[model samples]
Target chain A: MPQLALNRLRERGSTERAALDALLDDVLAGTLSTVVDGKPWVVPMLFARQGDRILLHGSTGAGALRHVAAGAPAALAVIAVDALVVGHTTFDSSANYRSAVVHGTLTPLPDRERAEALDALSERILPGRNAEVRPMTRQEQAKTLVMAMPIVDGEFLVKTRSGTASPPDEHTDAWHGVVELRTVALDPAPAPTSTAEEVPRSVLDFAGARVLA
Target chain B: MPQLALNRLRERGSTERAALDALLDDVLAGTLSTVVDGKPWVVPMLFARQGDRILLHGSTGAGALRHVAAGAPAALAVIAVDALVVGHTTFDSSANYRSAVVHGTLTPLPDRERAEALDALSERILPGRNAEVRPMTRQEQAKTLVMAMPIVDGEFLVKTRSGTASPPDEHTDAWHGVVELRTVALDPAPAPTSTAEEVPRSVLDFAGARVLA
Candidate 1:
């Protein structure tokens, strides 16, 4: 597929490879959309950014994954809202967000790379988790399917909106500002079957890094 | 298109109308996927849930919006992750999330209803702002395109995962639990051009409601 040119709000769109990589790394999950039998099918999945490609994994039996493995064109979108831009008119009110959409074909990772891809995914979810946790068994690896889509330049588009809303035409003592929004990690709740009494370093680190700014 | 059956992890799938409604209302933005000329295109958009339909608005000149208005089959997905499940193994870890996918065709709202739909979109981004802000201008309404997709019962699916991960076999004193994640609203930053010194009630109420929970 060719690069998607931003037809509207061109100021907010970019084709920078760095920006695309940063967005894929910042957002741990994305909505993967694919064409199956000429119909659009979209599903949210957890993904990890691996170099120039984003890795997506699911059960081998998943119908959507199967369609992608069969060379269906796919598009993955990651969006993160930074703030709410409040203006003096309903038309000016909007959100400040970073959105990236990647268009490509998915290729199933070979069996030899599945374990490493899984680790990258695990690390994305929880940094330093692979070393702390037990390795995946062969049976488990066999049941999972890992796929990668190349993040070629010009194959993705990144659009971002920031700053305050456009100044109102006739200001009249109306409040206008930006309300920053962030995803924060709260305290952990131990599972009933957990034997460990204290939170692990990986969990603590992940939580600590996500404190409200 | 027929309803998508959950081929894998059937236990996590749901067809309840209430669940689908709740997920759509909770997530302010979603990724809209549409097939264009036998290829997939996905874009992140801010939407409002109006009764049994989702209202999506954008510039009238947007290419994607035009495609949808031209009778493209589209799927909008809203996903909110509640927590990160930590387990003793990488394969066992996952995220607790509520995901809803609405599959339908987008219909452009009539010109008479455009202003109302824009208000709904604004209210979703900033509650109670309609009363405080001025009404949208005629030109603003003319330049904007508002489309609605019916959230029919059988055409949508909601899947959710909650609580902690499944217990690990042969435990080795690993920390296991869920780290709750929430989208929080921080202190508002007034625009430099604003004449008002005090924050508006609408912003305060919205921020207060989004504190860590």
Candidate 2:
């Protein structure tokens, strides 16, 4: 679609589905953009990728989601910043990042599939905790809204920038390099008087994997 | 403005300006949302707060910035994810995060103020590096676009969720706590065969300061 076209820095944009899915799976949240009541609105949402579609969760009463379910066009963007590229000149400086942008109309999941979507979301976020946590109640399921936006129709763009700064200038010779940026999981801080439970293998993996890098 | 009202989870929204500016200063990037050709578009942008306004930078040729400059109503959202709350039940699990959403029309900076704005942005993101780097050429200045969005008009909302997860059901006792998430600076990776320069004090401060927490 014309909307998915990357106008500037075209070299950074990618059409690969693998890169798009990998980026969607890597970041915890994305900014969902939609037109609501004749104005643009954006909100941060916790999301997960299941099969070929992205699952977004929110309260059924959210105005943005309500507008989205009513067929307002939407865009979801997930970005994972890897490092800061410091260049000799200010114009050449930038950041190394992986970004996935998807445009489509959201299809609200049926009531019967909300429970499964929730479990899948839990599994994607906290890998092994789906089985450990108590089952979601019928009332709880009724209160939530799950949205699925399929990855198709060339509506997605994945762009990444990595490596050291290299500006094509002869006079500038300050320091040029990249300082890595990463999202690291720290030790879990338990609530007061709560039992010290064993940390799950998934938490360990998430902490050690350097997934954003 | 009714457009800025937080329809769902209205309790999390804030009207205080100090809290709003503090959040605007802490985060480095935000998703700038605007309507282009009657469709919603969201793009990640590096931004800085200058007094009561937010400064956003991009190439002059960028389509999204072009749209914003053309008077499309915009929403800029900055979110810092502090931790992952792992709870006894999946339903109770969530994240501790601080978010600020600003709705406004962008005002393009004049040629007279572009230099000052560019310096302000560099100082905000890289801290001390502005002094170390060479001055931008007039050609470079012409190629860049700086737009400022004022934080006035009651079109702003700051929402925050912090603390450990507390599942409503008492019977289920899985693990419960928060795993902190942070953006840390690793050792600077200098360009190949480049002279090693000391990391700037601003960068050091950025690396040391837990801005999200």
Candidate 3:
């Protein structure tokens, strides 16, 4: 439960737990940072949040995930980019984003919990997907490694940059503000043999209520 | 110049140097992971490729960058999320993405090269922005810390997953294909006091060629 100190850009760092959860739940992907053997690695992995713990799954044979399960230190970073803040001056320009960094050791999930965790991940990424897809067989489950890292009390950082630029330079009379961007799901492309008339409801639901700029 | 070994998901790992360069050049943002004082940190930063080195700049007072400058080992991961591959089964669903992971130490850029690096970054993120915006003043340059990590011969990995799932489950009759996703710049919102009638050509150019879906 120790707090992770923000040693730089303290003004932009937020300790709000809601902000952390919101950022984690919204982003679908993140890079997992950990050391393997003697080399450092940043591995990209899909992640979903379950209560106070973050769920991450990968091939059971992945060495990086195995090391984390064995109690190696790790950090998972999820970033939701909002827009590019174009400032009147190059020095003042910055990207508008909501980023969360969580640090903890991952533990392997039990069989029963792992099943639910897999469904939870599907639901998070593609809502209503658990019902549309076939259940995972035992052999498939065995080959998958499901792990969770507690959203430790203070070992995280949430930083966000939104709204207009911090007042443009006085000498420059150029325009400045955020050019908003949103990630909306595009129409699904059905496989060659599939007969579905369109993307299923689950896919539609994922793009629901997008914050339009 | 030795190749970094692929220790996990060997099937998804790619060793082609061109693939690494292409992924790095296309993605605008990446997380820089480094260890400082025995604690791991994954800090998000904007990056651009210049020949054999990756250019990254931040505030001079930032601790994470300072550690990298002091020769702490670092990995910069750039990922371009291409799509979400929805499968007939929950277990088969996965995302389509191109990711590049580079491992190396960072060295601070000297004065002259630092200026060029800043312009290179601007051009990469916002093409033609260097000419569109006012020049960075000397004092502004002094407070900004620019650094580069050499793109070693084989100390990098590029992995990409595109197209439909690896043949869906035979028993399930669900649709399958990638739900493409792209990051396109939105209309620029000029500040309330600004006089520009429309977004600059550079901003428009960035989004012009997007494959609208």
Candidate 4:
């Protein structure tokens, strides 16, 4: 088991999983971790969660993904946060974070749920993204594999390690410190051409919302 | 070797690593991926790099980073932008993304380098973050284990997958698409009531200069 230290919600169970879903809903992609040869590997992928499952779709011909499709159990972990707690000591050091660890088998979506799942994956990150971009034809969908994982099997933690860093017993000579933190969305970037004036709804809706770090 | 799409620069060599450094100069803590049980595990960390090595410090007494001291190889990947790739097919789908992956064996840092590295790590992210936070005492530094990995041995890549997504192979049904991007920065929360207000010079400099997502 991995050693994790969190202050807000110490347990890792169903609540954590729900927190993972909410974070996933707020962002488009996360750093997916998998181990090969006892060495860790990570890839960024766009994903969609349907009920208890996570839908992951990549290239129909990505060689890296071939490793996952070939009987590999990956740990799909995503960590998003509202803040980072820089405590004085290691014990007190923590983050106000939301994360999920999904340990399970992944098989590429064959001819089945590929199309709909891909659409879900696209739209989940950017609402109305699917309609604005090119739609996949049946032939393309058949070749694309949409991998899904059951959410119940995954263990997630939604808690925060916030507050001052408590110094260890031996360190009395130093000053305590902290980073006053927050992440606020800035105004949208204007298009290169002045006439391209309208902003997408995705921007309008998420422009000022709080997001994971 | 863990499988990953090779087309993007984030997975390939050192140029991307330096670029990643320049990017991180803007943000402090980032999500990190570590390998455990032949599966990838992610933990958020505050890190800094010098020469060919990346510095990762863990509490000697607590948390998941204990795994690093116990001999786990982690791939530290950082992503700065998440843009909608206006592509037609899943294969052509891309994003205007800037990600850097550094893979190396985490080794215990020599006792001599601990304090300097810690200072570097703090300053790299927030410029004067180290000054605001309490300074590390000798005993505390002694107890903490700093992991160092050569940034050179690792492959780095930065993929610019931005542009319109047209359905693969067929140009006839292509619908025009655009890359819609957004990035956020904080509103600069002030210090708590007790602590004196600290406006770091670099931060003030950052404020005056325009930063585009």
Best by DockQ: 1
Question: Pick by lDDT: which candidate is best?
Answer: 1
Clashing pairs in 2: none
User: Model 2, range B72-93, lDDT digits (tens) per residue?
Assistant: 8999887777777777677777
Worst 10 residues of 1 chain A by lDDT: A1-10
lDDT accuracy of residue A55 in candidate 3: 84
The best candidate by TM-score is 1
Each prediction's DockQ against the real complex: 0.52, 0.46, 0.41, 0.25
Q: Which residue pairs collide in model 3, if any?
A: none
Kindly give the number of clashing pairs for every candidate.
0, 0, 0, 20
Query: Relative to the unseen true structure, what is the C-alpha lDDT of residue B112 in candidate 3, on a scale of 0 to 100?
Result: 87
lDDT of each: 0.79, 0.75, 0.73, 0.54
TM-score versus the correct structure, for each prediction: 0.94, 0.92, 0.91, 0.75
Residue A92, candidate 2: how far off, in angstroms?
Answer: 1.4
| lDDT for residue A27 in candidate 1, whole number 0-100 | 79
lDDT of 4 at A76: 65
Estimate, for each residue in A115-160, the C-alpha lDDT of model 4 and write its tens digit: 6777776666546656654677676665565677666632544444
Candidates in descending lDDT order: 1, 2, 3, 4
The deviation in Å at residue B152 for candidate 3 is 1.4
lDDT value, candidate 2, whole model: 0.75
TM-score of the second chain in candidate 1: 0.93
Query: After best superposition, candidate 2 residue B140: deviation in angstroms?
Result: 0.9
